[model samples]
Target: MYTKPPIRKIIHVDMDAFYASVEQLDNPNLKGKPIAVGGDGKRGVISAASYEARTFGVKSAMAGNLAVKLCPELVFVKPRFERYHEISKQIRAIFHDYTDLVEPLSLDEAYLDVTENKKGNPSASLIAKEIRARILNEIGLTASAGISINKFIAKIASDYNKPNGQKTVNPEEVISFLETLDIRKFYGVGKVTTEKMYQKGIFTGLDLKQKSLEYLDTHFGKSGRYFYYIVRGIHNSPVTPNRQRKSLAAERTFSENLSSEIFMLQKLDHIAEEVSNRLKKSKISGKTITLKIKYSDFTLHTRSKTLTYFINDKALILDTAKDLLYQESLNNSVRLLGISLSNLNTEAKKNTAGLSLNKKVSVQLKFDF
Candidate 1:
């Protein structure tokens, strides 16, 4: 006799308009009003928009000016990361009470694997409900949760019910659920990819599933292979716990756009110093350095170079960033400068031995403007 594979239980918990909700919770006066958490300055980016604000077409990451135009009565509040971190800890602790296999996606979202939970609860749906309740009762904030056989379905389900609701997708319903999901709703499918999929006559998961693996691989490359499997509900990527940071970065937006090379270099130096200091504190080095530039018009560009050896020195980071900056002519006045280090060497001591011996080597900067 042949046996079927056991279904895994996964839950994705996401806080609802986390920052905006927190602002309302802390200040009762802000409740039931259109509020946005972020700066309201000229270069300010909306971090989170309340449901009320969303009604007025306000959204996070939208320019402050544009958001204001969308909602004239919008209230902007500066973000309090320290407070958010504290709340995240409290939420994570609650997740630990049910299972240790918790993978945090951000301060407001996490994936929990409870195939064999500590509570001995067989129903992942009940567990998700309880977790959402605990967050509301204890943290005084609302959270939404999704329960399914795997992370992919659970993550998408979590968004189905908004603002203090939960949804569960049983194993039997996975196929139908995926079939009806829009292609844009698929993970990692952005505007460009969505347009490409439309051009290929793939507008939904069902359409995507119709393509052969060879055809998808040829057109979408690595991502094509991912789409092929995901549409068929074949995602087996485990919910990773304690995911390592692939990069550490620091960035700053200036009050005024800087056009002079001297002024731009000065900002790059500070940004590089900040990134190097962070790498030092983390006790890591990286081979790849990325320079992020945001133009005055809010267009973004990045230039990256992978070095021959890992480095975490302030002077080296500054020099590398300066060189990358000079390699490209400014298409527009720069308003923000940032430096990031990736391909991290976690074993800092191993790389330190050859740190002094490592020489400066140039790699062509890859541009994404």
Candidate 2:
């Protein structure tokens, strides 16, 4: 007689308004008030906003001036990346106490596989609760979690209850949970994809499920198969620790548009130095150099060159960027400039713990958490 495969237990944990919350936690005066973490200048953008700020339509990536207009009392604070990273390390240490299979998506969120955790506790939901509580007690920060059978569903579930809450989607409920989900709430679906989905009369997971695989593939290219499988609750990706870095980049947005190449050269030199320093710090190198240009009208352009040999030298990177800069005439005055290196030397580790897509969800199986 064959035995059924055990369902994988995955948990996604996300910190609540991380950057702004950090600022508030460190400064009592900023608590319970609308605050943003970023520069407050003509070209400044809000990197993060507190829950109070969010109520007033202040949000991350929104222009600082616009955020101020939306909420007259919005407070702008400079980002403290070093402090955030320090706190993130503390959070990751807490995660490792429960499981070794932790995949960090960013400093604020991660995916943990607690099926065979160090705690030896069978309930993933309890593990998530314990982790969140530890974060709060030890680091003085609140976290939210979503527990499910896979990363995709867990990630979406984590956002269901924001600002310090947890949600669990049992194996039996995965199909129904996904079917009723709003198209916009699906992890990878963005504004452009949502509009495209609406145009195709697909507003929910159920509607997407109704489309044939061939239709999805034809209309959505490679992403069609992804949608087809995920709606049916068939994601098999495993939690991977130490995900490889794909690219390194540095960019600057000018307060005023610059029309002259001389001015752009100075900016490019600074950017290339930053990128080269970062690459050296990480002990990584790449062959492809891409120069990104954003005109005053917001039109974007990119030029790239892939070298036979990898480079992490600032002079070489600057020379390549300068060549790309003069490769074509300026369409208009440039408002932003960026340099990025891809095709890195880092190797990706193979994950051998993926769940089987062929495994069936059994209602008879005990749902513990």
Best by lDDT: 2
How far in Å is the alpha carbon of 323 misplaced in model 1? Answer: 0.8
Model 1 C-alpha lDDT per residue in residues 123-229, reported as the tens digit of each score: 88888989998999998999999888778889999999897998987876777888889999987899999999999999999999889878998999978767866
Model 2 agreement with the true structure over 89-129: per-residue lDDT tens digits: 99999999999999999999999999899998999999999
Off by over 4 Å in 2: 1-6, 349-366
**TM-score of candidate 1 against the unseen true structure:** 0.90
lDDT of 2 at 110: 97
Residue 269, model 1: Cα distance from true site in angstroms: 2.8
- Which candidate number maximizes TM-score? 2
User: Total clashes, candidate 2?
Assistant: 0
Lowest lDDT 10-mer window, candidate 1? 360-369
- lDDT of every model, 2 decimals: 0.84, 0.90
Off by over 4 Å in 1: 1-6, 346-369
Give candidate 1's total backbone clashes: 0
Query: Over the full model, what C-alpha lDDT does candidate 1 score relative to the true structure?
Result: 0.84
